[model samples]
Target: MRQQSSPHLSRGFSSYGCALALAALVALAACSKKEAAAPAPRPVVASIVHPDGQALQAGSLPGEVQARYSTPLSFRVGGKIIERRVRLGDTVKNGEIVALLDPADAQKNAASAQAQLDAAQHNLVYAQQQLERDKAQAKENLIAPAQLEQTTNAYASALAQRDQAQQQAALAKNQLQYTTLVAGHAGVITAEQADTGQNVSAGQAVYNLAWSGDVDVLCDVPESALAAFAVGQNASVTLAALPGRKFSARVRELSPAADQQSRTWRARLTLAQPGPDVRLGMTADVTPAVPLATAAAQHGLFTLPATALFHEGRQPAVWVVRAADNTLELRRVTVTRYDERTIVVSEGLKDGESVVLQGVHTVSAGEKVRAIAPLHPEDFAS
Candidate 1:
C-alpha cells in the first residue's frame, strides 16, 4: 500500500502464503488416518461335546455264562473206592467207566451164590427122578400108597428150594454189576468229590459233570432286574475268559425266591449247541434280549462323559440345563451302565439338552455363564 508495491514482489508474497496453507492441510490429513481395524468379535460358545450319544436299544444287556445241565456224579451202591480212571476236567462218553469200587467181596459173594444155585439144580434133578420111580412102584403095587404120597411131598419141597437158591444167585449178580461206576451221558467231569480207597455210601457224589447235549447258564441277577427276565426270552451270552466270542442262550428257569444276602435272583439259561472246547464252570455272561414291543424310550436326553459321574447318596446324579434368562436345574441321574468313555443315563435327561459334563465342579446352580455351542452328536456303530 505504501509504494503500491511492485507487481512481482506482491505475487511472490501471495505464493509463499499459499504454500504454507497447503502444508498445514497435509499435516491434518496424516493425523486423520484410522487406527488398525478392531479384532473380530470373539465367537459365542456353549458347552463342548467330546463324543456324542447314540440311540439305545433294550436288547443290549449284561449277562453271564453258565452250564445248563450240571449234576454231581456218584455211585449207586456203597463200596470202598478201588480205582479212579478219570481225573478232573476229563470228558467221558455215556456208559464209559469212570471209576471202580473194590470188587473183592462182591465177586466172592457172586461166585458163592452161583455154586449154591448149581448145587440146588442138581438136587432138583435127583428129586424128580426119585419121585417118578416112586409113582411107577405105586402103580405096579410094589409100594404102599402112603409111602408114595410122602415121596411126592419130598420132591415138591426140593423144587421149592432150588427156585429160592436161583433167586439168591441173581441178587448176587446185580450186586457185582454195581461195583463199576460209569457216566450216565457224554459230559465233562468238573471235580473229584472223593479219592481212591475212601469208603463211600450209596448215592454218594464222586464227581460233578456237565452234560454235553443239555447246556445252560446260571446267573444271579439283581432283584430289581429279575422281573425284566422271563423264561423263553432270547439272550446273548459271553465269557470274560473267551474275549470277542458270544453265544446264544435263553432263560429256562427263574428262582422264585431272592437271595437273602444279595437281594438277587438266580436265572438259568439254556445254551445253543455248545462246542467241545466249552467247559463247565467257566465264567459266563448272559444278556437277555428285550423284545422291541416292550422296549420304551424318552426324548431330550443330555449326553455326558463317563467322567461326570460322581456318587451322590450312593445314587448317580448329574448337573443339567441352563437358561439364557440365568436359570439352572440340577438333575439327579440314574446310571444304566458305562464303559471306558460314556455313561448311559436311564433317567433325568431329555434329548437336545445341555449338560455340565466338563466343568461340573466349577459350575453351580443359578450361576450366570456364557454358553458356547455344543459339539455335534455321534452316530451309533452296529
Candidate 2:
C-alpha cells in the first residue's frame, strides 16, 4: 500500500512542475514581443554646413527722400513782406516772383533821388552858363582872371555833384527791384520762413526751395556700418509711401566728418532716374548692394535661417548634427544679430560643420537623421 501512494504523489509533483514550466515559456514570449515593439529612430531633415562659402548678406536701413539741390531762398533787401505770391509746395519757374516786400519806402527813395538829380542838373546848367559868361568876359578883358577861375571851380563842383546824384538814383532803382523776391531756379517751395506782414532782413531765408532735379535717399549710418559704404556703390531704394516700387540708386556723397550730435556719417544715394511719384521728404528704405567680396570682408559672420534658432530659457541655441553618425546635439551659440531673413551667428560655430536647418524642434539629442541638401545656399542665409 505504501509503494502505491508514493507513485500517486510523484505523479502530482510532476504535473505541478509541468504547469510552472508553461508559465515560464509564456513570460518569455511576452518579453520578446515588447523588444520587437521598441520605437525606431525618428527621421529628421538636415543640411551640411558650408560655412565658408556662404554668401554675404544684404542689409536694409531706414532712409528719407530729399532733393539733391535744396537751397534757402532769401530777399536781397530788407522790408516787410506785403505779399507772398507762392505758398508752400508751389512750383515756380526761374525768375518767378515768390514774395514781395512793401515798395512804399523804396519808391519814395527813388523819387527823392530823381529830385536830387534834377536839382543837381539845374545847378550844373547854371554853373556852365556862368562859366561861359565869365570866359567871354575874360576874353573881352571885361572881368578879372580871378572871377573866371572861380566860375571854372564852381562848374567842376556842380558836374561832380550831378554824377553823384545819378549813382544814387541807380542804387535806389536796384533796391526797388530787390523788393521782389524771385526764384533763382525752377523749384518747389519746401518751407516758408517768413509770412505776409512779417519783417525780414536781407538774406534772411524766407523760402526753402528744392530745385527740380535728381533725387537722393538720405540716411545716417552708425560708425560700425560706415565701413560697409563707399562712394559709387550701387544701392536700391524703396519708398514707404509708394509700395511695390523700387528705384535704383548709387552712393553719391559720404560726409567726411561724422555728425557731432549723432556721431553718424550722413550718406546720400542719388537715384538713377526718379519719377514724378518720388517726392521730396518721403520716407525710404535704402539697401546697399555691396559686392560679395567687399561684403564678406566687412561682415565675417556666419548666417543661418531664423528658423534654426531655438531658445533654451533666455539663451539662444541650435542643434548641430554629427557628420559621422548623423546624430544631433544641442549647442549654445552667441548670436551677433538677426534681420528679417537670417540669424547672424557670431560665435560658437565652426566652419564646415553640419547643422539641422529644419525640424529643429522635432529632433532629440543623439537621434539619427538624414542630411539633405538645401534648395539653395542663400536659403540658409535667409
Candidate 3:
C-alpha cells in the first residue's frame, strides 16, 4: 500500500513547471527590445556661429618695402661702357653722372662738324664781298648784268650751306654729351644691368634706380581677399627688420587683372611717413583698418571650423543644434570660400546659434545630442 503513487499528478506538476519557464523568457526578450529601440544621447563638440567681420579684419598679408618709383636707368646712345660711377646700392643725386662711355668717336664727329662750319663761314664771307663788288660794277655798268646776277645767286647758296653746317654742328655736340649717362632723379641704385667694358645699344639698361622720395609696401593679395582692399583705404604696416614699430599707410594702387601664375593681385600701399630704418626689400605685414562690425554687415558672412562642414550629394551642409530639444538638423549652407582650417559661410546661419564642430559624419538628423565646447579650441582660431 506505501509503494503505490499517482502518475497523473506527477505529470500535472511537470506541465506547470514548463509554463513558468516560457513566461520568464518572454519578459526578458521584451526588456531587450525596449533597450534597442531607444538609444542614449550622443555628445558632440560644437561652437557658436559668429560674425566673420573680425576674422576678416585680422587678416595680415605678407609684403615687401619698396620704392614708389622704380625704373631702369639706361643710356640714350649706343657705346661701350668705359666706367660705372655708381655701384649697387649707391645713392645718386639728380643730374649726377652714373656711367661714362668712350668719347673718342663722338669727339671726332663733333670736331669734323665744327671744321665744316668754319669753312662754310669763310665761304660766306667771300660771297658777301663778291656780291658787294658785283653791285658796284652793275651800278657803274662796268660788268655785264648777267655776271652780276650770277654773283648774287652764289652769295645766297653760300648762306644756305652755312645754315646747314650750323645745325649739324649743334647735333654733333649733343651726341658728345650723350656719351655720359646722367641720373634724371635722386635715387638709389638697386641693380646693375650693364657692367664695365660691356657694349650696349641705345636705351639699354645700365642700372635700376629706386627713387628716393615715397616708400611703398607691395603685396600680392589673393582674389578672395581683394575685396577688402580698395584705393585710399587705410592700413598698418610692420616690418620684420624693424620690429616694435608700425607705419601708417594708405592703399595707393591695385592691379586691375590677376597675375597668371599666382592668381594674386598686386597692391601698392604708400607709407605716410616711413622712417629711415624702413629699407627696400625688407619683409612687411599689411593689415587693413576696416571695422569688424562694418565688414561683417557688408558681407553677411559667418565662420565655422572645417570639421563642421558636411556634404549632401554635391551641396555643402552643416549640422545645427535646435535649442528647444537639443536635437540636430542638417542645414544646407552657402559657402563663400574655404580656407585651410575654416569655412566662410555667406548664408544659412545666424549669430549665437550652436553648430557641430566635429563628429559630423556620425550624427543623424533629428538625433538627440549634448553640445560641448571643442577640447582643442586652438584649431578654430583662424
Candidate 4:
C-alpha cells in the first residue's frame, strides 16, 4: 500500500472514535439519573395515651346459671305408672303427689301376707294349748318329758312362722305406699316422662324438679387458673338475658379435684339476689376477683398483647427501648398476670419508654423498626 501506511495515524483515528462513543454514553446516563429508590413506606399511625392509676382491663368469661339444689326423680318400687299427677313446669310443695303406680298386685300380696299371719298365729295358739296339756300330763306322769319337749318345739316353730308372715305383710304395705309418689321438696318441675299406664322400673325418673334454694352461677375454671379461687371469695356475675343487671356473688365451693376430660375445677358462686326473673339453664358470666397485683398507688404500668411476648429459652422477654438509637431492645420482663385479652407487665418497663405492643413476630432484638401505638388504647391500664 502506499509508503509504509502510517500505523500511528490509523491507531489514533480508531482511538478517537472509541473515546467519542464513550463520552456520548456518559452524557446520556447522566441525563437518565435513575429515580431515587422509592422512599420506604410509612407505618400506620396509631393513637396512644397515658392511663389513669385506677384504670383496669376488665376481663370477662363465659359461664352458666345453675341451681344450688338439683334433685333426681326416682321411685322405690317397680310398677306400671297408672296416673301422672305432675308435668313439666308444675309448681309443687313438699309431700305433693307427683305420680301414681298400679297398686293392685301389691294390695293382693299384702292381703295374702295378712291371711298367712292370721293362720300362723291361730296355729301357734293351738300348739301352745297342746303343749300346756302335754306338760300337765307330764307333771302327772301320764306323758314322757320328751313328748312334752316335742310339743314345746312345735309351738316355737308356729310362733316363728307367725313372726315371719307378719314381717312379710309389713313389707307389702310399705311397697304399696310407694304407689303414691310424692315430692320431697318445694320446687318447680323441670321434666315429666311417665304417662298414665306406662310400665316403669324401680327408681325410674318420672319428673325433674329444681328445688328452691340459693341460686348460683357455676363456672368451670381451668386448673391452670384454679389456684386463685377459694371458698368465700368474691365474684361478679352477669346474666345473658338481662344485660344491665349484675349480681354480686360469693364463692360457695372450689373443687380441688380436676375434671378428667377438661382438666378444670368447678367453681360455685352463690348469687346475692338471683331474682325471680332468673330462670334455670340461662347462661351467665362469672368473673373471679383478683387482689391488687401491685401497689394501689402504682401509676402508668406497661402493657402489651400476649403475642408480643417472645421467649428466650424459658425466660419471658419483651421488645423495649434499648439506646438512644431507634433500635429494638429485648427487655426481660416480669409478667405478673394475664387475661384472655391483655397481659399485665409488672416490672422491667418504665412509664415513658416505648414498648412494642404488636407485630413483634417480624422484629428481633437490636433490630431497627418503626414504633407504633397499640390497636386498643383501652387495653392498657395503670
The C-alpha stretches of model 4 lying farther than 4 A from their native spots are 1-58, 242-244, 260-262, 291-382
- Give the lDDT of residue 79 in candidate 4: 90
lDDT of each: 0.70, 0.83, 0.88, 0.73
Flag clash pairs in model 2. none
Give the alpha carbon lDDT tens digit for every residue of 43-153 in model 2.
Answer: 555565544223324467689999999999998999999999998999999999888999999999999999999999999999999999999999999999999999999
Give lDDT tens digits, candidate 4, residues 1-382: 5688699999999999999999999988876665333344234222232222223343444677877997877789999887887888878999999888889999998899889989998999999899889988998999888898899999999989989998998998899898889999999898776777788889888888889878878888643344335788787888889999888998889887877765567888899988899988889877667532222224334446676676667878877644477667787877765656556666776655666666656676666555566667656432
For model 3, residues 1-382, the per-residue Cα lDDT tens digits are 5786699999999999999999999999999999989888889998787676545545688899999999998887899999999999999999999999999999999999999999999999999999999899899999999999899899999999999999999999999999999999999999999999999999999999999999999998754465567899999999988889989999999999878766578999999999787789999989878743555656677777788899988999999999999999999999976777878788898877899988899999999999988787897675
Candidate 1 per-residue C-alpha lDDT over 16-129 given as tens digits, one digit per residue, 9 for 90 to 100: 999999999998777665432333222222343221222333334444444567788888789999899999978899999998999888899999999999998998899899
Model 3: lowest-lDDT 10 consecutive positions? 291-300
TM-score (C-alpha) between model 3 and the true structure: 0.65
In every candidate, how many clashes are there? Answer: 22, 0, 0, 0
Better candidate number, 1 or 3, judged by TM-score: 3
Off by over 4 Å in 3: 1-5, 40-63, 103-178, 220-228, 238-246, 257-265, 275-278, 282-287, 291-328, 336-345, 349-364, 367-382
Cα misplacement distance, residue 77 of candidate 4 (Å): 1.9
Off by over 4 Å in 1: 1-64, 140-148, 260-263, 291-382
Better of 1 and 4 by lDDT: 4
